[model samples]
Target chain A: MKFSINQKDLYNALNIVRRAVAKNQTLPILTGIFLKLKNNKLTLKSTDLELGIKYDLTVKAESDGAIVLPATQFLNIIRELPNEDVYLELNQDKWQLQIKCINSLFKINGYDPDEFPNLPQVEESAKFELPANKFKEMIKKVRISTSKDETQPALTGALFEVESEKVKMVSTNTYRLSFIEAPLKTSVNEKIAVIIPGTTLQELNNLLEDEGSVEVEVDSNYARFTFAGIEVISRLIEGKFPNYELVIPDESNSNFSADLSQLHGAVKRASLIAKLDANIITLEAANGLMEINSAEGSSGYAHEEVKIDLEGPDQKINIDAGYFIDVLKVLDSEEINIEMIGPLNPLVVNSQKDGDKFIYLIMPVRSQS
Target chain B: MKFSINQKDLYNALNIVRRAVAKNQTLPILTGIFLKLKNNKLTLKSTDLELGIKYDLTVKAESDGAIVLPATQFLNIIRELPNEDVYLELNQDKWQLQIKCINSLFKINGYDPDEFPNLPQVEESAKFELPANKFKEMIKKVRISTSKDETQPALTGALFEVESEKVKMVSTNTYRLSFIEAPLKTSVNEKIAVIIPGTTLQELNNLLEDEGSVEVEVDSNYARFTFAGIEVISRLIEGKFPNYELVIPDESNSNFSADLSQLHGAVKRASLIAKLDANIITLEAANGLMEINSAEGSSGYAHEEVKIDLEGPDQKINIDAGYFIDVLKVLDSEEINIEMIGPLNPLVVNSQKDGDKFIYLIMPVRSQS
Candidate 1:
């Protein structure tokens, strides 16, 4: 490959594709980034078998060819180079790529481009488009509830369901769950559902921008997301996702709303001692106040009180403090509505703003007493 | 102890003494911060036996008492609390500290203050004061050459010599050396010298600010540094320091000066490939050009050329790229003067500014050829 590209443009392009580069993979080529030059366009691709990313940029190309270079080393070199024109030439026989930028020159050993695996394809089973910002917001909330345990494959991903008018994403790790929905910008003729791995959702959430919309194509085996001239293909999990709707509470015996920032601060302070034990803290909501107390052990005890506007019976629940903190961090509203059926049911934290359909559920830990 | 302290002020005071708190120390009390409430001032002290830090702040004291609490846990708790009045009361029987801030309350377990070690004292010693920014700058440059190998105790510290007219700090790891000198504002009748430990230099560097001055006291056993509201006491390294004056080159056959930023950028880019091997790079300087090339290996090769102003014969030498990069990062001048006698002699990188007396020496690596 022969190309002269701006250091910043190349660095930006490399950054997008390098996210999919395999780390500690057995196949040597999987650790390399595939680069191809044609006329005036350069294409970069990387794949770790489960996920892949591809990006293209226009460059000053003297010849059209292909080469695969070590992803990390090349990225490091380009990142350190000055923001000027960078010239690259490939030696097909020895597989050495010579890179020159201003007064700095480097010759890096590369591999044959043919050895790198091609990106997996997604059949056109269903296609829909959603606002990039809203999709990213939905993913951020759903990610906190995805299970890290590998034994239950379905729980490791979020259930993405698309109807003709709306889109919903739900994830549950048995103890906590997240459900977020948004209006679909582009309508689909048929209903579709897919389970995208948590890691893929994280990467997509990081890459999506607020200004543009992303086109999503899903099939039985793969899902492709296209946004901002970048393409991401992720393998879908093959298992039955649990029915999360049944777990959500239909009514509550106790309900209240409180300032989001105040409650967040209270829980974090209580967690200083709570985290020392099982990360569990009890929340007691009465007429006009909510008290949070951490279980005392060898460390010590922590108690916090937050004023709230309650409209139902008094309630007390013990749940993981970290789970409550995670949902609070993703919330943007000034106030949050909390509801509980009793001490036995889950504590539900619902966003109070209109048109914001984000609900978080944290299961109460069983008390021996 | 019973006191009401501002959360911000308490957090700030905790930060200073926490630096001296021992990590994984044998004595449990050494890992705790000693707190004392006497009159209206609260004293906080922490020591790891080798180094100690003390800070004092005023608070509303209802009673007078003292105790020791785990440094990290207390710092973390105070950091998370809101900027409000924090009430602290001690349970003298069980040695438990009850902390209340706004609506948050915490009970922390503490140890008896009698078990904590006292801060070391410097006897009748030599004392001097210098601009905090200037002292911090000298420490930053000298600390890079301090040896990481603990076998040679003296080499793991910087020889601080205070003369009637000038103050100099020198450190050498045998392979490279850094010597920094500054004009003494206050003349002394007697000369004093001591070796300050590397960890002490690091902490002092972090604590010193640009606006004020620091009072330094040095004796046979300890060195005390007092600045702002913080005081640091460090044990002096016990051994003879190497004579670094012999390592500096007296004269050079080739002397040249180059743009500091240009050389810095070139060397950093070249080191990207040189570090893949043994971090060795060859510098060829003659006429008005200086060329830098990495020692080629299986990874690849790198070459960089920078413009310079030369006044003597051509010179070529091989040296560690990391050592060269270290001095470049510390230099604040726009131009750097480089001098070399021959291939076998050390390469000298001295500051060009007339008022600044900083010299760095990097010994040449004899080529196998």
Candidate 2:
């Protein structure tokens, strides 16, 4: 391949595709980025067999060809080059790619483009579009609750369900759960549900821009997301997701509201001491005053109080401080609304903004006392 | 002890003294900061046996007492508190400290003050003062050459020497050397030289500010630096420094100058490929231009060119690209001056600013070809 492109454009394209480059050496070619130029369009793609990313940019083409270069080395060299015209050429006989920009020139050994595996495909007939900003917001909240435990493959991903007029995402690790729903208009005639791997959700969240809309497609074995001139294909988890609806509390016996920033700061400070033990903190609410206390450990004790507007009887519960902090970080409301049925039940944090609803649940830890 | 201190002030003081807290658990108390309240002064000190740091701030005291608290835990807690008056009370019976601020309360376990080790002192008779900014600059340049090899204790630190009107610091790891000298008037009649440990140089660099002057004292076993209401005491390395003067080239067969930033950028790009091999790059200077080339390894080849003003015959040498990049990063000059005698001799990089002279020498690596 022979082409001259702007340095910044090439660097940005590399950044998008390099996210899917294989981190392990199980397949050597998978650790490289496939580069192809034809009809003035330069396409770059990378895949680790489970996830793949592809980006394209227009360039001044001298010849149409292809090569697979090491993603890290090529990206580093391009990043350091001055913002000017960058010339690239491939030597098919030796499988080497030559890069030249101003006074710097480099020849990097690469693998044959033919050796690169094709990115997995999803059924385009099932594709639908949603607002990019809303999709990204849902991914951020749901991915946090995805399990790191690999034994249960379904739990390591988020369940994405889309209807003709509504979209919802849910994830749980048995200890905590996140459920988010947004009203989105689409032309799809049937309901679709798939489990997207946690890694794919993270990368999608990073690549999605707030201004555009994202087109998504799903099949039995693969899912695809396209937005902002980038394409991402991820392998769907084959196992069935658990019944998450039964885990979310349907009603609450008591509810309260407090300043979001104040309660966030209080919980973070309490966790400093509680994290030394099991990261467990007890919350007690009564008389318009909410008390948060860390279990006394080898470090010491921490107690914090935040004023709340109560609507029912007093309540108390013990829960993981880290889980509480995670939801608070993602919440952008002025006031945090919390609901609890009793000490043995889950503490539910739910909010609504711009017609979208988000609910987070933290399972209570049985206190020693 | 009972006192109410501003949270910001307490957090800043903790940040300074905690630098000396022991990272290993040889002695539990050494990993804690000793707090003493007396005569309206709140003193905090931490020591790791080899190094110690102390700072003092005035507070509203109701009584006088002392205790030792874990550095990490206390620092973290104080950092998270609001910027308001924080009340602290000591429970002598339990050896615990109760801290209250607004609606937040904490009780941290601490050790008895009597068990904390006292900070080492330096004789005041042998002290001299130097500009804090100048000293920090000298340390930044010289510390980069300090060896990480613990087998040679003296080479792992910088040799600091001060005369009546001149101060110098030198450090080398056999591959490269850094020499910095500045002229400043002092009251000392006798010359002093000591090897300051690498960790001390790092902490001193971090603590020193630009405005004030630093009072320095050197004894046989320890060196003390006091500035900005902070005191740092460090143990001196008990070994003789190598004769670095013998390694620096006294004369050169060819001298050249190049735009500092342009050359820096070129070398950094060329090293991208050189580092894949042995991090060795060859420099060829002639015809008013310099050519840099990386040896062809399993990765590939890299070549870069930089314009220069040259005098005398042409010169070429192979040296570690990393060592060359280090000096280039530290030099704040428009043009970088280089002196070379032959391929077998070291390459000298020296610059003079504000009557202060800085010199760096990079030894050549024998080329296999």
Candidate 3:
């Protein structure tokens, strides 16, 4: 194959596909990206068995052929090349690639394209288009709470609940739960729930542009997203996502409101000390003031207080500072409302303006004292 | 003990001494910083047996006392505290520290100050001062070549040679050597040579300011540097340094000059491909052009040529791309002169201008082919 393309275009396309290429895979062929030049277009495909990505870009084709080259090495070479037209040609044996640009020329070894595994065929049963920025925001707000432990495979994925006009994304690791909702344009008559791996959602979010819209297609077993001449396909996690709505507290005996930034700052300050003691920080609310504290002997102690408008009884609770910080960072609200039921019960936090649609619940830890 | 100090001042002092505290040491006391309050000054000291640093800052002192607090925890607490005056007082048992600022209070456990190791005393033998920026520049240029292997302890330190009128610093890892020199203000009757650990030199450089000057004191077995209200003392490595001067080629049959930036760009681009093959890149100079090439099967090859003014025989040499990049990055010269005696001999690189006295010698790798 012989083709010439702009360095920037090729670099950008390769970057999108490079994310799916396994860094160290048992199968050597899985580490390469399949490059095909045909009909004045170059298509790059990479996969790690579970997920796959394909990027296509237009180029000036002199001939038509296919080759598999080391994904990382090829990307690195193109990334470093100056912004100019890059000429690529396949040798007679189809085992060598020659790339020339400006005053530079390179000869790289290529593997047999036939050795690459075939990409999974994506079948669309339901397709919907949503604003890319909105979808990305929903994923970011909930993905962090997904379980990292592989044993409970179900908790490693984000549960996507789709209705006729709205979609909700929820994720939890049994310690903290995050739920975010966005309006969707769909004609589905029945409720659709699917457990999508957090990693796949994260990659899909990264690939979407802020200004454009994304088209998502979902089936019983797989989901596919297409945008900007690139397609991503991921297998759906096969398990039941827990009923998160049941766990969210319906009402609380104590409720308080505080400036989000002020509370976030106090939590961050207290975390410096709490991080030494298993990331536990105690929040005490009494007399219209909330105090955050973490103490570890010989290490140090950190304490900060924030005045709040409250309609609740006095209470103190110990919770994971990291979990609280995660929810606080993602909530796009100036004021936040926190509901405390009991010292050892799950605490609920939600944006005052967002109301109950995007609720976050975090379980408290037993006080060490 | 009782005292009040600004949070910013305490944080700055803690940061400077934190560099001297070892992360993981068998002795627990070595992991903490000894804080002494006396005569309205707070002294923070940390030592790792080989190196010690002390920082003194003025603070409000109600009583004179000393305690050892965990270095990392104290630093973290001070870093996150609000910008305000903080009050610290010893508890009734004198083993706990109570800190208060505004409406927040924290109590942290502390170790007895007597358990902390004593810092080494600085001796009066050789003393001199140099521009902090110039000294930092010298260390930056040479320190990269210091050996990381512990088998040869002397090579892990930068060799400091002080003569009657000249001061020279050299570091080598057998494959590469960097040497820098500067004029001395203090004349010495006898030559003073010592190997100061590269890590200690790095810490001292970090503590130094670019526009100021630093006083350096060297004794028979140790070296001390004082600047920015901080004093650092490091034990000298006791061993003979390799004779690096003899390895640098005195004259060359082939010489080439090129723009430092252009050459660096070409090298870095080619290195992206070369790094896949153990960082080996070949440089071929013939007729007025220099070409760099690196290729690994299945990965790829990168080739780039730079125009140069050469007035010597044609030559080809293979070298580690990373080592070559290190030499160029540290030189800071606009124009670089590369001199080669032969394809297999060590290549010498130096500045084309006269103001900077720096030389880098890189040994060529024998190409497998």
Candidate 4:
């Protein structure tokens, strides 16, 4: 195979596929990226058995052939080469691949391309497209709460529930839960819930462009994202996700509103002292004032009072300050409303202004009396 | 004890001393900073047995006392608090430190100040000062080559050689060596060579400010640096340091000069194909052209040529590209001259311009063939 392409264009295309290539896979061929040059186009594909990515780029091709080269080494070489046209050629035996730029030449050994796994086919299924930025924003707001523990495999992924008019994304680790809703263009009479691994969602979110839109297709067992000449396929976790809607409290006896930044600052200060023991901080509300405190022997105690507009009786709740800070940071709101039913109940947090559909619920820790 | 101080000023003082506080020390008191409030000044001191740092800041003192608080926690608290005047008070047998700022109150437990280690005495020994920026630059250039292996404790420190007219610093790990010299003002006719630990030099370098002079005092067994209202004392490594002067090549038969950036770029590109089997890269110089090459079976081989001005016969040498890159990055000159004595001998590298006193020596690796 022989081809010439812009250095940057090839770098970008390889970067997306390189994410799926594992560093030390049991199979030696899995460490290489399968490259095929056909009809003036070059295709790069890589997979780790569980996740796969394929990207295609146009190049000036003088011959057509295929080769598999070390993904990481080739990528690094291409990135460091001076910006110029890169020429790639495959020998007759296809056992050696040569890449040249300016006055530099890199000759790399290639594995048989026939050993590479076949790319999965995406059949006609429930397909829809959404603005990339909007999808990324929704994922960022909810993915942090996904369970990191493997014991509860179902909770380790985000639950995507699709309906006729809206699509809901929910993630929880049984301690704190995040739910976000966005308008959908697809109409379906039946509800579909699939547990998508949090890691896959995060990688996909990073691959999406900030300004453009991405097309997503989902089947019973897999989901595919197509954008920027690349396609990402992730397997769905086979399990039942817990119903999150029932866990979100609808009414609260105690409610208050405060500037998001102000509350975040207070929590951060209190967390310094609270970090000794799971970062548990106490929040007490009384007479329109909220006080945050953490006490650890010899390290000292931290207490910060923030004035808020309250609508109910006085109450105090002890919760993990780090969790609250995470939700507030991702909410990206000027002001937030915090609703509490009781001291031992889950606290519902959401933005006070209109137009945002993000809600976060954190279960309070019972204080040791 | 009671006092009030600007949060920013207090944080800065604490940060300077925090470096001496070890994270996981056998003695618990070593993890705390001794806070001494007396005579309208707050003194923060931390010690890790081998080194100690103390910093003082002026504050509004209503009473006088001392306590030891957790270093990291206190620093974190002060960092998160809004920039304002922070009021501090000691309560309950001086075991709790209450910090109040704006509407926030933080109380951290404190240990008895008597348990903290004693500060090292500042002896009336040789004393001199130098420009902070210049001193920092000298340390930055030589410290990277300091030995990280603990087998030879003396080699793990930089040798500070002081004379009446010049101050020289040298560091080596048997593979690579760096030497830097600068003029100094001193009246002591005696010469002193002390091995100051690399960790201490790094910390001192970080705390130094630009455009000012730092007062330095050295005794028989310790070195003290006072700058920016902070005093740092470090125990010198006790042992006989190797005669590094003998290891540096004094004469060369072949010499070559090239642009520092250009050579660096070529070496880095060639290193892509070289892996951790000593990462050996070969440099061949013939007829005013230098070629760099690296080969690994099945992985790849990289070759790049750069034109240079050679002053001697053709020569070929194999060296660890990573080590060469490290020494090249420290040179302040745009053009570097490399002098080769033989194919399998130490090479001397220095700036092409006259009056540059810095030199780096790298030993070539013997080829297995």
**Candidate achieving the largest lDDT:** 2
Off by over 4 Å in 3: A92-94, A295-300, A352-356, A366-369, B92-94, B295-298, B352-355
lDDT of 4 at B297: 43
lDDT, candidate 3, at A202: 80
Residue-pair clashes per prediction, in order, are: 0, 0, 0, 10
lDDT, residue B213, model 3: 76
Candidate 1 Cα outliers beyond 4 Å, as residue runs = A352-356, B185-187, B352-354
Candidate 1 chain B, run of 10 with poorest lDDT: B350-359
**Model 1 agreement with the true structure over A1-369: per-residue lDDT tens digits:** 788999999999999998999998698788889999898989999999999999989999899899999888899899989999999999989888999998889999889898888899887658878888888889999999999999999999999989887888999999999998876645787778889999999899788888798999999999999999999999999999998889999988888999999999999989988898899999999869999999877878899999999988999999999999999999988999998999889999887344758899999998812
lDDT at B89 for candidate 2? Answer: 99
Q: Give the fraction of native contacts in model 1.
A: 0.84
Alpha-carbon RMSD, each predicted model: 1.6, 1.2, 2.3, 2.3
Q: What TM-score against the true fold does each predicted structure earn?
A: 0.98, 0.99, 0.94, 0.94
Candidate 1: clashing pairs of residues: none
| lDDT score of residue A280 within candidate 2 | 95
Task: Give lDDT: candidate 1, residue B337.
Answer: 94
lDDT by residue (tens digit), candidate 1, B192-297:
8899999999999888889798898888999999999889999999989987787897888988999999999999988988888899999999769999999777
Residue-level lDDT of model 4, residues B262-345, one tens digit each, is: 788888988888753457888888898889888554477889888889998888888888888887777777788888978888
Candidate 4: interface RMSD equals 2.1
Residue-wise C-alpha lDDT for candidate 4, range A69-147, written one tens digit per residue: 8888888889988879999999848478999988788888878898888867667678777778878888898888999
